[model samples]
Target: ADGYDSGGSDEREFADAWLMRAHGHNAVDLDEIDAAEDALQETQFLLDDFAGLIDDFESQGGSARDLFEIVRQVVNNKKTEAGETN
Candidate 1:
């Protein structure tokens, strides 16, 4: 019954998930990993800035920040494991 019904959540989720996978696959490649991390950081910043505006988005759209947080945590976990193995 709101803007989310327009497929915003699905689309954003899809994009974030796809990019997260791409980053994970290339995590060992410093350049790709750094670029992906930077993009994730930017996404988080935007979500934080518009936290209030989300309410205006109808059905209360979810924050991309949450999605980004998951990706970051996952990446860091892998990084930690790599460090431990080294």
Candidate 2:
């Protein structure tokens, strides 16, 4: 969902792997491909925000980890909404 930053191949592979672990993951289980695509786009927005936080000289104002935590929350919330998490 990270905005399909990895694109379709990467996204498909991720969904396939996750489905395998979930045992018989299907279209719904993985979510509509379009939804995943949309989520990826949203994440790109967050990434841009994170990148902007970098100091003008490329120094870190803070660890990118904070942004990553937010990203994790976004994706986790979606998964929970779909009832697709442990």
Candidate 3:
């Protein structure tokens, strides 16, 4: 909220400058927004195993990145087990 606009009119001048730099003199593009949203959703799906990994790590202490690596390994195994990558 400090560096970016959250629709507050009190910072109109700063927000306008930020917008000009962000959008490069072009109108805001909905297609770009949609594509970014779609990419985020896709990444969210891949992290479906994150919750389980956190629980597992809590029970057996290890680095957080280790848990993420374990989740990535499990997901990779599952994908390869089915002979597909999704």
Candidate 4:
């Protein structure tokens, strides 16, 4: 979903709805907003790391590339799973 072959669609939709409702009521919760922003920032950093790992793998041609991708996918999948439960 969300342009990625990976998961997390349900989590994304729920969060978006929560934010919209909070904004509509003019009662935004700073803690929740901060937590969401933090999660996004953390995920972005993980993605940046993945990009760097890919570049390094391309240049070095090592065996770890597959392992790295697998790890990334697993982490992302977990995030999607957690999001769905919320």
TM per prediction: 0.30, 0.30, 0.32, 0.43
Give the distance in Å from residue 10's predicted Cα in candidate 2 to where it truly belongs: 45
Q: Write the per-residue lDDT of candidate 3 for residues 1-86, one digit (tens) a residue.
A: 47664667768878778888998678878999999999999888767677666677777877788767988999999999999977
Which whole-number lDDT from 0 to 100 does residue 83 have in model 4? 88
lDDT of each prediction vs. the true structure? Answer: 0.75, 0.74, 0.81, 0.82
lDDT of 2 by residue, 1-86 (tens): 66546656888898888887887644354467778898999999988886676543246455556767887999999999999975
| 1 versus 3: better TM-score goes to | 3
What TM-score would you give candidate 2 relative to the actual structure?
A: 0.30
| lDDT tens readout by residue for model 1, 1-86 | 66554467888888878898888675567798899999999999998877656555434666657756877888889989888532
Q: Between the candidate structures 1 and 2, which one is better when assessed by lDDT? A: 1
Best by TM-score: 4
lDDT of 2: 0.74
Which 10-residue window of candidate 3 scores lowest in summed lDDT?
1-10
- CA lDDT of 20 in candidate 4? 83
Q: How much RMSD separates candidate 4 from the native structure?
A: 20.1
